[model samples]
Target chain A: MSFRLALQESPGNPWFSWRYVQDNSDTILAALREHAILTAEAMLIATAVAVPLAVVAYWYRPLTGPILALSGVLYTIPSLALLAFVAPYVGTTNPGSVLIALVLYALLLIVRNSLAGLNQVPPEARDAAQGMGYGRWGRLFRIDLPLALPGIVTGLRLATVSTVALVTVGALIGHGGLGDLILTGFRNNFYKAEILTGAVLCVVLALVLDLLLAMAGRLLTPWSRRAVR
Target chain B: MRSENPIQQALTWLNDPLNWTNPGGILDRLGEHLWISAAAVALGCVVAWPIGMWLGHAGRGGSLVVLISNLTLAIPTIALLTILPLTFLGFGKPPVVVALAVFAVPPLLANAYTGVRSIDPEARDAARGMGLSGWQVLGRVELPLAVPYLAAGFRTASVQVVATAALASFVNGGGLGQIISAGFGLGISVGGGQILAGGFLVALLAMLVEAVLAVVERVVTPKPLRKARGRAARRAAVATGSA
Candidate 1:
C-alpha cells in the first residue's frame, strides 16, 4: 500500500494529474493561446476565401474542375514541407506565413463542403422558397445558406482539427504554437516537464476547441441537429 | 517578399552528383526515408487493420471509429514526436517511427471502416442469403469491396508518413530534414535555398505517392464501382470517411 501510494504521489508518475497540471499552468496556457490564435485565423481566412470561390464555381460550372484540381494538388504537399518551404520567404517568426499556409489546407475542405452544402440543399426547399416569393439572392441568403449550415459546419470542424495538428508543424516556422516547446525541448534543453506539458496541453486545446465547435454547431443549426439526432 | 531563388538552388542541389553519392547522401537518405516511412505505415496497418476490419465486418461502431479517428487526427505529429522521446523512447529513428505510426493509424482505420460500411446493404444481405457464413461473407464479399478504401487509407498514411518523416532530423533521426534543418540552423541565406530544396523534394515525393496510390485505387475498385469513382469521387470517399 505504501509503495503504491508513493508511486502515485510522485510528480513525474502523476504528470497528468490535477497536482502536476497546476504546476505547469503557465506553460499550458501559453501554448493554448498560440494554438487558438493560429487555428482561428486560419479557419476564418479559409472560410472567407473558400465560400466565395465555391459560390463562383457553383455559378460558373467551368471553374469547378480547375478549382478542385488546384486545391487537390496543394493538399498533397506535406504540412511540414510547406512550413519549411515557406519559412525561408516569410521569415520564421511571422504568424502570417503560417496562417497563409494553414489557410491553403482549409481551402479544399471548405470549398468542397460549401459546394456540397449548397448542392445538397433539396430542390424542394428552393422551389418552395421561390413559390413563396423569395427572389434569387434572397433564396440563397434565406434558404440555401441556412440549409447548408450543417455541412459547412462539418467542414469547418474538420478544417479546425486539421489546422490544430498543422500548427505544431508551424514550430519550424518559429511561429509554431505548442510545437515550439516540444521542438525546443527536443533540440536544446531536454526536459520531460516541458515536452509532456506541451503535448498534453496541445491535445487538450484541440479537444476543447472540438467540443466547443461541436456544441456551437448543434446549437446554431438546431434543424440539422434534429435530423442528425 | 520573394527574395531568394530557392528553385534555382534546389535545381543546383539536385544536379550536384556529390549530393547523391556522399556518405549520408541524398540517395541513402532517400532510401532510409522510404523504408522507415514504409515501416511506420506497416506498423500502423498492423495495429489498425484488424480492428477496422472487425468493426467494419460487424457493421457496428462506424460512428465510434470515426469519432476516435477524428480525435486522433487532431493530435499534432510534431508534439507526438517530441513527447515520445521523453517517454523512455530517447531520440532516434524508433521514436520517429512510433510517432509516424501513431498519426498513420487514424486514416487507416477510418477508411477501412467507411469502406465496409458504405457497401450496399443488399449486397451484404445477398452474400448472407447465399449460404455464406459470417467469416466467409466478410472474406469473400466485404473485404474485397473494401480494397479501394483500404488502398486509399494506406496511401494517405504513407504520404503523410513520408512528408513528416523529414522531421525525424529534429531528433537526430536521419532524413532529408537534416539538410533542411541545417539551412534553418544557419538562420538565412544558403539555408533558405536548402529548405526550399528539401521541401520540394518532400512535396514531390508526396505527390508521387498520391499519384501512384490513385492509380492503384482506380485499378482495385471493381469495374462497376469504378464507373462512378472518378478522382473526385475517390477523394470524397476518403475525405468523408476520415472526416
Candidate 2:
C-alpha cells in the first residue's frame, strides 16, 4: 500500500497505532540507538572522571568539601540552562555539547557516591592490608575499592538513569536522540503515536539500564551477597 | 551585534533598561517562573508528604518508595511536559503545574520516608513508654527528629521544581524559559545573547533557591541534632588522621 493510503487508515490522533509503528520502525530504532549510545558514552566518560576525582578527594580530606560543593553547584544548574551555556562554546548542533553537559551533570552523583564508598571502607581493613605488606596503591585496589564497589555502583546507576532522562532535553539543540522524535511529534500536530512511543522507550531504556547495573553490582561484589546469606 | 562578542552582546541585552520595564521583561518572567515553581512544589508536598510520612511511620510501602524513585528517574521531564498538554488538561499553566508536581514528588516522597525510617527505634520506644499516643509520638518526637530529612527533601524539591519549570515554556506555559526559547527562535547568531542571558538568569535563580533552602534546613534542624552532627564530623576527621 502507498504511504498516503496507510496514513488514512489510521484514526485521527490515536495515542497508539500499529500502522505507524510498522511504517516508522526504522526511524524509531535509529532514534533509540542514538539515545542508548549517547547515554553509554556519557556515562563511560563521566565514570572515568568521577572515580579519579573522588579518589583524590578521599586521599586529601581538605579537597573533599570543595570537590563536592563544586559538583553540587553543577548539579543545581538546570539542564536546559547548562546545555544553553555549553552550546555557545561547543556549537549547538554538535553532540559534543550534549556529551559534555551530561558528563557534568553525572559528576555529582558518581563523585559523591565514590567518596562515600571509599569512606565506608573499614579502617581496620586498611590497617590489616598495610600490615600484610601491601603498598598503598595495592591496598586501595585490593581492600578499599572492592569494599566501596556497592556504593560506587549505586552512584553509576543513578547517574546513568538521570543521563538517559536528560538526553531528551538535548533535542533542543537538534541532537536529542529519542528527544528529537518526541519534540518533532509534539511540534507536528501532536502526533500521539510517535510521542507515546518516544516517551515509553525512554522509560524502558532507563529501567533496563538500571536493572543491568544493579545486577552487575551484585555480580561484582559477590562477597556482599554471600555475607547476606 | 554580530561584530560584538557574544558575551558583550548578552551584557548589552541584559543592560537594556527598557527590557526591565517593558511587558514580558526579565522581571515579569522571573515572577512567572517563581509562581509556577512554587505552585507545583506546594501541590507535590500536599500530595506526597502525608503518604510518605504515613507509610514511613507504619514501616510499610518500602517497595513503593523504590518504585516511585525509579519511575521518576526513568520518565523524561520534557516528555511529561509535552504529553500533559496534549491530554484533556490542554495547554497552559494547569498541565505545567501537574507535570512539575509529578517531577517534584519523588524527592519529596523518598526523603520523607527516609527521614521517618531513619528515626532510632529506641526513640520511638522511649516516647511510647512516656505515655505518648501513637499520634503524639509521630508528631512530637518522630517529626521533630525527622526535620533535617524533610528540610533536605524540600530543598531538593524546590530547586528541582525551579529548574524544570523552565520547560513549562514548551507548552506555552509562562516562565523564564520563554526567554531562552524565544532566543532560539531568533536563530543563534542573532539570539545568542538572549539565550545566554536566559541561561544565566535560570542558573542564578536555582542557586539562590538552593542557598536559601540550605539556610532554612540548618535553622529548622534541632540544635541537639546539629551539635551531634558536628561531633560526628570531628570524630570522623580524627579517625581519618589515625588511619
Candidate 3:
C-alpha cells in the first residue's frame, strides 16, 4: 500500500501508469468506443454527400470549379472554429454539430478523389460500353464507378484519418470522444498517463482504420493488384 | 438578446473599435496566431526539407519516411498540444509551436521528397554530362525543377498551421482561439456574438492565407511548366465536357 502511495506521489510522475489504466479501464474503453463511432458516422455521411457532389461536378463542366473551390474554402476552416460556428445552431445537446462540421471538412478530399477517379476511366472504355448498348446510367455504374472505386476509397481513407484527428477538437464543446479524457487529464493536474493513453489510442485507431481501408480498397479493386503484378 | 439574430450581434461585435485595438484584442490575437503559425511552418521546413531532400537523393527508405510522416497525421492535435506541456517544455507557446510544427512536417517532408524524385532522369543526366559536380547538379538542375512541389508543400503547411494554430489558446498559447474559448467561457447567452466573430475571423484568416499562398505558388512555378499544366487542365475540361 505504501509502495503504491510512493509511486503515486513520486516527484517524477511516470508517463505510462498501469495504475491509471487499471483504475479507469471502463472510462478509457467507453471513450475509445465513442471516438470510433463518431468517426465512422462522420465518414459515412461525408462519403454519401461527397460522391453525389463529385458526380455533379464531373457531369457539369461549369460547376466543377465552383464546387471544388467551395469545398476548398470549407476545408481551410479550423476544426475548432467550424465546430464553434456550428454549435450555436445545433445546440450541442448531441454530436450533431460535430458531425456537420466533419462532413464539411471531409468533402474536399473525397470529392476531389472521386472526380479524379471518374476522370481516370478511359474514353475507350466508355465508348466500348456505349457500343455494347449500355445506357448512360448503366455505363456510369458499371464502368465509370468501378474504375473510380480505388480513388474514392483512397479519399475515404484520407478523410477518415483526418476526421478522426479532428473529432478530438469536438471535446471543446463536450462531444470530443477521447478528447474528453485528454482535456479532463489536463484540467486535473496534468495527468500524464491519461493524456498519453488518449493520444496513443487516437493514433492507433487512425493507423488501424487506415490499414483496414487500404485492405478494403485492394479487395474492391482486384484488377489493380493484377496490373501491378 | 435571445430574440436578436446571432450573426447580426457578431457583426456588431466585430465592428467595435475596442475589440480591434485593446489589449488582448482581435489584432493582438491575430498577431499571436500569425507569429506561432509562421514560426512553426518555418521550423518545419527547416527540419523536414533537408532530410527529405537527402532521402530523395539517396533513393532508399524515402517511402518509409513519407509513410511514417503521414502516419503522424493520425496523432490528435489537441492531445499533442495538451500533452507536450506536461514534459519539461512547460506551458504556453513551446508546446503549441512544437505540436503545430510536428503537424506541418508530413506535408513538407512528403512534398520535398516527391519534388526531387519527380525530376526527369534525362535532365539530371544532362546536368551531370555538362561537367557539373554532384552538388552542382542538384543545385542547378534538381532544385529549380522542384520549386513547384516545395511551394505546394509550403502552401499546405502554412494554411494548415494557421488553422491549427487556434488550438494554441488551449495551452495558454494565445491566438484567435482565445476569443472563441473566451466566448465559450461567457456562455452562449452572453457571448454568442463573440463566438461567431471569433469563428469568422479564423475562417477568414485561413482562407486569406490560402489565397495568398496560392498566388505565391503560381508566381514561383516555372513558367513553361505552369503553361503546360494550364493547357492540360483546359484539355481535361474540354474532354470532360464533350463526354
Model 1 agreement with the true structure over A1-229: per-residue lDDT tens digits: 0122332334554334565457867766786788789999999999999888877777689998898788877777877677777776777667877888899877887887777788788999988999999987898789988888876777787888878878887777677788877787567545555666677777777777878888998888877755885
Candidate 2 Cα deviation (angstroms), residue A137: 2.0
DockQ per model, Cα = 0.44, 0.39, 0.46
Model 3 per-residue lDDT tens digits across residues A99-194: 899889988878888888898888999899999999978988999899899879878887888888888888877778998888888877778788
Candidate 2: where is the Cα deviation over 4 Å?
A: A1-11, B227-243
Off by over 4 Å in 3: A1-12, B228-243
A50-69 per-residue lDDT for model 2 (tens digits): 99999999999999999988
Residues B6-108 of candidate 3: C-alpha lDDT, one tens digit per residue: 7887988899999999999999999999999999999999998887776776676665764655577677888889877766566667778888999888777
DockQ of candidate 3 is 0.46
Query: How much lDDT does candidate 1 score?
Result: 0.76
TM-scores, chain A, per candidate:
0.85, 0.93, 0.93
Categorize the docking of model 1: acceptable
Candidate 3 lands at a TM-score of 0.92
Error of 3 at A79 (Å): 1.3
- TM-score ranking from best to worst? 3, 2, 1
